[model samples]
Target chain A: EAGVAQSPRYKIIEKRQSVAFWCNPISGHATLYWYQQILGQGPKLLIQFQNNGVVDDSQLPKDRFSAERLKGVDSTLKIQPAKLEDSAVYLCASSLGGTTVRETQYFGPGTRLLVL
Target chain B: DQQVKQNSPSLSVQEGRISILNCDYTNSMFDYFLWYKKYPAEGPTFLISISSIKDKNEDGRFTVFLNKSAKHLSLHIVPSQPGDSAVYFCAASDITSNTGKLIFGQGTTLQVKP
Candidate 1:
């Protein structure tokens, strides 16, 4: 089975420029997530989508970041007027609908973003 | 505030020895905990997980132990091999939420030498 897929494995943008990342989840997976991992840190959830609707986006920077999952299959994350601090690895993950109490999340190769 | 923390940034162990990576969390609402291993430039891969109701979960050479009372959890690798060298992250999730979003700790880099 194919794993989660992400495009533009690496991206470099100047401060104040706009950038966008894309993700395609595994087939049949209903839950999708976007995470940001700064250097030396674990991935932090930026947004989550359940099927065609958003489940959570509490940690996302509303002023600068936005994401959308159309038809709940592929998703896009965008950052406008990037700041140096926005540099980080963006990861996409997907999991089948919850069966047990805990669900296993499979991740993609991740897109490394560097804002200069 | 950082809800999850891995106090140690790095650890080194000789091959064939055991490697223990620790993590702590401040939230009591977490119902599931997981461990993930990541290599440079790649995303984290799920290693093992333990539910809050259970104290231990084992899979092959990897084991996860949870101490809910202390809000501490650990990942233990038996007979650690050089291939196991990578950054290990601990994550927690609150099942009650619709998002089931995971909160992660700073990673611990493990170096296993032959």
Candidate 2:
């Protein structure tokens, strides 16, 4: 089985500009997540999608950040009017969500976004 | 709130020694704990994990020890090699019970010398 896939291994954008990152979850995976990792800090969860529905997005900045998983297989995270503080690596992960401890998540190669 | 923390920012060990990485959590609701390894420009790769009920879980040369009373956990890589050098992150999740959110810690960078 293939692993989770993400696009644009690296991204550099100017402040106040817009940027988007895409993620394709593993086959048959039902849960997808987006996280942001800043230098010297742990990853912060941005949003989560269970199938085509949003599970949790409380941490996402609605004023500038938005994400969508239309068909539930692939997802997109967009940041409009990016800020310099938004310069960080965006990671995507997928898991077979259920009531089981065996459901492990697989992560993809993150998109490193640097807002100048 | 910062629920998880890895106090050590970096560790150095010679090859063939035991590499121990530690983590602490403040949340009592976390039932499952996982460790992930990450290289530069890549997302974290799943490593060994231990549930709250179990104190220890071993996989090959990797082992995870959980201390629920102290709310601490550790990852042990025996006979560490150069290939084991990477940033290791400790994460806790409320799986199979409540919310499925993973709270991660600031990664610890391990450098194994040949």
Candidate 3:
């Protein structure tokens, strides 16, 4: 079985510029998630999508970050007016079901973004 | 408030020896715990998981021990190999949430020497 897929493994942008990351989850997966991993720290949950609807985005920066999963299979995360602090790896993950915590998540290669 | 923490930033062990990684959590609500291994440029891959009800779970050469009373967990890799060298992250989730949201630790980097 194929794992989660992401694009543009590495990205570089100037401060205040906009950048977008794409994610295509595993087949038949019902839940998708976006996370940010800064150097020396573990990945932090940015947003979570259950099918086409958002399940949680409380930790996301509403002023600069946004994400959407229109068809419930693919998702995109965008950051506008990126700041130097936003330089980190953005990881996408997906699980089989949304109702069970036992489902194991499969992660993608991740997009490493750097804002200079 | 950091709910999960890996105090050791790195660990080195000889091949064929044992490698142990530790993690601690402050949240009592976390009922499910998991361990993930990650290479330098790739994302984390699930290694092993143990529920709160169980104190230990083993998979092949990897074993995870959970101490609910102390809110601590450890991952053990026996007869460690060079391929086992990577960053290990400990994650937890509260089943009640039903969303499968995971809270992760800072991660521990393991280096196994040949």
Candidate 4:
């Protein structure tokens, strides 16, 4: 079975510029998530989507970051006016269902962003 | 507040030896805990998990022990292998929330020397 897929394994952008990352989750997966991992730190959950509906986004920076999963299969995370502090790896993950605690998440090779 | 924490930033062990990595969480509501292993430039992969009801769970050479009263857990790898060198992260989820959200700790980097 194919795992979660992400695009632009690496990205570089100037401060204040806008950037976007894409994610395509595993087949038949019902839950998708976006996370940010700064250097030397664990991945921080940014947002979660359950079948195109947001389940949680309390940690997301609404002023600069936004994400959407229109069809429930693919997702896109965008950051506008990116700051140096936003330089980090963007990881996408998926699970079979959203209601179960036993669900194991499969992650994709993240998109490493470096804002200069 | 950082609910989960892995105080050790790194650990080195000779191959064929035992490796123990520890984690502590402040939240008592978390009932499920998981361990993930990650290689450089790669996303984390699920390794093992333990529910609060169980004190220990083992799979292959990896074992995870949970102490609910202490709010602590540890992952042990027996006869560590070179391939086991990676960053290990501990994560917890409060099943009562039904949100399926996982809280993760700053990972511990483990190196196995041959």
Most DockQ-accurate candidate: 3
Q: After superposition, how far is residue B65 of candidate 4 from its true place, in Å?
A: 0.4
Query: How much is the lDDT of residue B32 in candidate 1?
Result: 91
Which regions of candidate 4 deviate over 4 angstroms?
none
**For candidate 3, what is the interface RMSD?**
0.7
lDDT of 4 by residue, B1-114 (tens): 999999999999999999999999999899999999999988999999999999999999999999999999999999899999999999999867666789899999999999
Query: What is the CAPRI rating of model 1's predicted complex?
Result: medium
Docking class of 4: high
Model 2 segments beyond 4 Å from truth? B95-97
Error of 1 at A60 (Å): 1.0
Residue-by-residue lDDT tens digits, candidate 4, A1-116 = 88899998999999999999999999999999999999988999999898999989999999999999998899999999899999999999999984565799999999999999
Q: Candidate 3 lDDT, tens digit per residue, B41-76? A: 999999999999999999999999999999999999
The TM-score each candidate achieves on chain A is: 0.96, 0.96, 0.97, 0.97
Instruction: Name the lDDT of candidate 4.
Output: 0.95
Task: Give each candidate's fraction of reference contacts reproduced.
Answer: 0.80, 0.68, 0.86, 0.73
Clashes of each: 0, 0, 0, 0
User: Per-model C-alpha lDDT, please?
Assistant: 0.91, 0.92, 0.95, 0.95
Clashing pairs in 1: none
Error of 4 at A18 (Å): 0.2
C-alpha TM-score for every candidate: 0.96, 0.96, 0.98, 0.98
Interface RMSD per candidate: 1.5, 1.7, 0.7, 0.9
